[model samples]
Target: SNNDYNYTVDLSDKSLILISINYTVSETLEIPSTYLGRQVKNLSSSIFVTTDTSNVKTLILPDSLTTLDNTNIKPIYTLENLVIGNGITEIPDSFANYMNNLENVKLGNNVTKIGKNAFCGCARLKEIKVSDSVKYIDDYAFIGCSFNKVLIGKNVEYIGDEAFGYFDYILSNKGNSNILNPYYVINGYSSTAAEKYAKENGIKFIDLNNQPADTEQTYTYINDLVAGDINLDNKVDVNDVTLLQNYSACNVEFNDFQYKNSAVTHYITSITINNVTEIQRYLSGYIDTLEIYSVG
Candidate 1:
């Protein structure tokens, strides 16, 4: 009765069709290319009920597949690799939950929408490449992935709330000190909102409006000096003193000048003059030693 049952029904004029399959074992399954007459457009609900998931690695969806909304089709946990065909446009919510070992995901070129929490909790996922055809990415689509980087394609327009929530978590955690902070380089996004968000959350945002022509542009700060060395010569000395002297004179013509040169020397002279009284007490001792040496 299982083999003879019809798995396909014509729905050319209708909008939807429902089919049922009853299986009692877990094993390698190659879904038939065509069931009855109409092409197998979707995997029926509760089609695979076996607990042993060792043999399942690849799932090839038919071109006619436009939806995979079956609640009982939870075989995604057993699948290490999933290839969605060009016909599918959306992935259901929480479709990839608990799939800790899924490493790579190749989204179809025609897919337009990804549901919320679609790929949450994929801890071992290394990369996600959304195609140019994707227009909307739902909230938390990649919430808790351990991937170090994320590459958003050009066609994406909207990033929902908490889409990068896990990234913030990783940065705040004490264990991830060695991981470099993620830098987000977006071409066309909300400049005001993105700037505000990055500032508040300590995330790095790079504006790519006009990137440097080559690597030489990165060397523009060869002369920038902080507190340690003001002259940019990698050492502090008399030249620094000269700079401070010129600065205190209020000479507006020169750009590099320091006020410490004049102020420090005046302070030292005042200190020496104030200690002249103490120097008088040791002067007689020095004269006595000179007289004894002359007599000898």
Candidate 2:
């Protein structure tokens, strides 16, 4: 670690291991993905074991990071911010447990598992999100937390004992089950584990797919009368011929909006394509149309 540098890293095989940090570092620390011309990949458990928290607060990991210890967040008790990169695959056991100062967190997109006791005893943990890739939440994962809202992704299939429990009675009064309410309004896909847990345990639930599906639009096939309109420009020209020749004869595609707009342009500019489910030949009356105007 250099005296002039605020962050410290150990590189091996082109991957990064966040070794440590200087006590005098600023409040927010952003770890870089590249160091000494190599890619950074991992952050060990001991990176923040000895750092001072007087001024240190936010920690932002790089998107290239694939391995990290979720439980060994930091020894900084006063810190309040953390950001997980999308490269992370899981949240290990006892992650950030008892870290009452941590107010918010957004789990990475690749995270597939939430281990046991991951966020237990975090009294101030109000905002949290589980990615759509997550498949399971282990037992006691969020015990004693204060998050008021949560979203369970569609892939989640299991909810372990007391995974989101806060009190003993919240789960069950007659059965041995520890299926406590999540204490939050849960939004997830209908008939999923998320919906089942919310319903069986009397927690609030919102179906993710309850909203109407996108409206399907259809377009009419208007066979153009102009020759060499391969780029869908209304008139025949050398530009169309050149474009057609370069790509082994152009197979141009245009949506309703693009075709309609380009027909009105003094000359066609930018074109956008979308939702082409079926292929129709341009040769209904195109044979006669091409003969009427020779390609330029």
Candidate 3:
């Protein structure tokens, strides 16, 4: 073990496998590409499964790592940044699932497959751009997450059920789980798996080949602002709900009064797809009135 970091390893005839890291290492763990004379190729199946990983905020897998050894049994709550190296081809099942604070990820160009529930329940993730080298995305790979945009690559061939564009289950009505639909837009090529998935799930899709041009708008707030009346149309309806969804996905912007009206949860800064659900509930007679949380 001639490496600077303290980590136990198992040596094979040609490569080295990382067993476990000493708890005293830095928060940013950049696994060594080589140890002594052998390529560091693998991590133990139970790597990061312990409570010792509470301090690791940033993790960078080495370029020599070609495979994972069943390490996705649990989530690393503290990990805020991740970088998958170029040699890895598959993202393992439940990789980084439920990581509450994870904000960024850099997937390698060699990655071809994303396994089931790979990034599920990561609410803070604002956007993700899948690389063109990826071809398969397994079920629930990115479900239970909210984002402004998801850019699927053109080469993706198969996308599993609820793999993208769905948010977490926020309400349970009469013993039935009510999952909130995503407000983000999915960007991909026409006639590809991205388009197919977006159509099947009723998510907004933008074709990169035939994208619409951006237009400038002069937004003005009405004197008497009504809650959920996003367009200042004097009445709340499904169109306001659509506008709120678009605003959450970055497809549209809102003026100050419109932003105040969009706050259904009583907190303007906490607006999310759940706010969309509130509007839907009000429209369906499930709720009597929309709560006005931000009254200026």
Candidate 4:
């Protein structure tokens, strides 16, 4: 039987796992957070085969879920966007196999491991920001895909070979026809796996640690700002606090403009967790001003 959200569910160990959607037509599919007073925890691998999902353009998996089971998550051919919620820790192997039209994906902040061949054959996925919480990315996790820009976090302990690039097939179809993208760029910190991988694979590595030289014009731009305004919305508040926390956790990366704003603590070089604390103190009214440190 279908639940209120038209999802077929199975109750296991007092939690609900979605079996499939029973609907005939739905454009955007949002996995229900709760069903019959129990939290929905998983999506059956056969979910896509149970119903017509060709019309679904977006899929939002909520934070209440913890697992996307092993085996290929049968494709939703027309799916263009996918949002994975924060409760999930691992993405099963071959999870999104052959999703050719998939363009954008937002991974949850808590995702720790990306299983083997998890995104195999997703040729249209252009960019992905792997959260700081991810440590292990298994072999061939991103093989057979097209990714031009990837923002890997600081805590990634291991990156499986060919995870983000497959040289001969991943070419730049935009600017110069003969140019390749797999060797273009990878934005990450210095002396990390992200840099090592880029170097070994012939990709251009942009070390987040080594930002552009601060010019006279840059310092002038820095002096005219509130120190804790990491997002630069012209105010220092709780939102800046959250952005600082995310930046500290390596969940988000900042541009030069935001980086200057975040260097509020007394660091000799870069932004650190101390800045987050400083922002908190300022918000609590424990301190009056945020000292803008001169960072090189």
lDDT for residue 188 in candidate 2, whole number 0-100: 80
Off by over 4 Å in 1: 1-33, 50-53, 71-73, 165-296
Candidate closer to the true structure by lDDT (higher is better), 1 or 3: 3
Q: What is candidate 3's CA lDDT for residue 170?
A: 30
Clashes per candidate (backbone, < 3 Å): 2, 1, 0, 0
Please list the residue runs of candidate 3 whose C-alpha ends up more than 4 Å from where it truly belongs after superposition.
1-13, 49-51, 72-75, 170-182, 212-296
Each candidate: RMSD: 19.1, 21.8, 9.5, 17.9
lDDT of 1 at 253: 27
Reference-based lDDT, each prediction: 0.47, 0.57, 0.72, 0.70
User: Residues 82-156, candidate 4, lDDT per residue (tens digit)?
Assistant: 999998899888788678788788999999999988887677776678878998898778765655567788888
Superposed Cα deviation of residue 270, candidate 1 (Å): 50
**Candidate order, TM-score descending:** 3, 4, 2, 1
**If both were scored by TM-score, which would come out higher, candidate 2 or candidate 3?**
3
Better of 2 and 3 by lDDT: 3
Pairs in steric clash, model 4 = none
Backbone-clash count (model 2): 1
Candidate 2 — which residues are off by over 4 angstroms?
1-12, 168-183, 211-296
Residue pairs in collision within model 1: 243-258, 244-258
lDDT of 3 by residue, 195-259 (tens): 99889877778898899512121112122457788787779999999998888898986544466
- Candidate 4 Cα errors over 4 Å, as ranges: 1-13, 70-72, 168-183, 212-296
Please report how far candidate 2 places residue 86 from its true position, in Å.
1.1
Candidate 3: C-alpha RMSD after superposition: 9.5
- Candidate 3 lDDT trough over 10 residues, lowest sum: 213-222
Instruction: Give the per-residue lDDT digits (tens) of candidate 1, residues 50-101.
Output: 3334566665555567776863345656666666767788878877765866
Model number with the top lDDT: 3
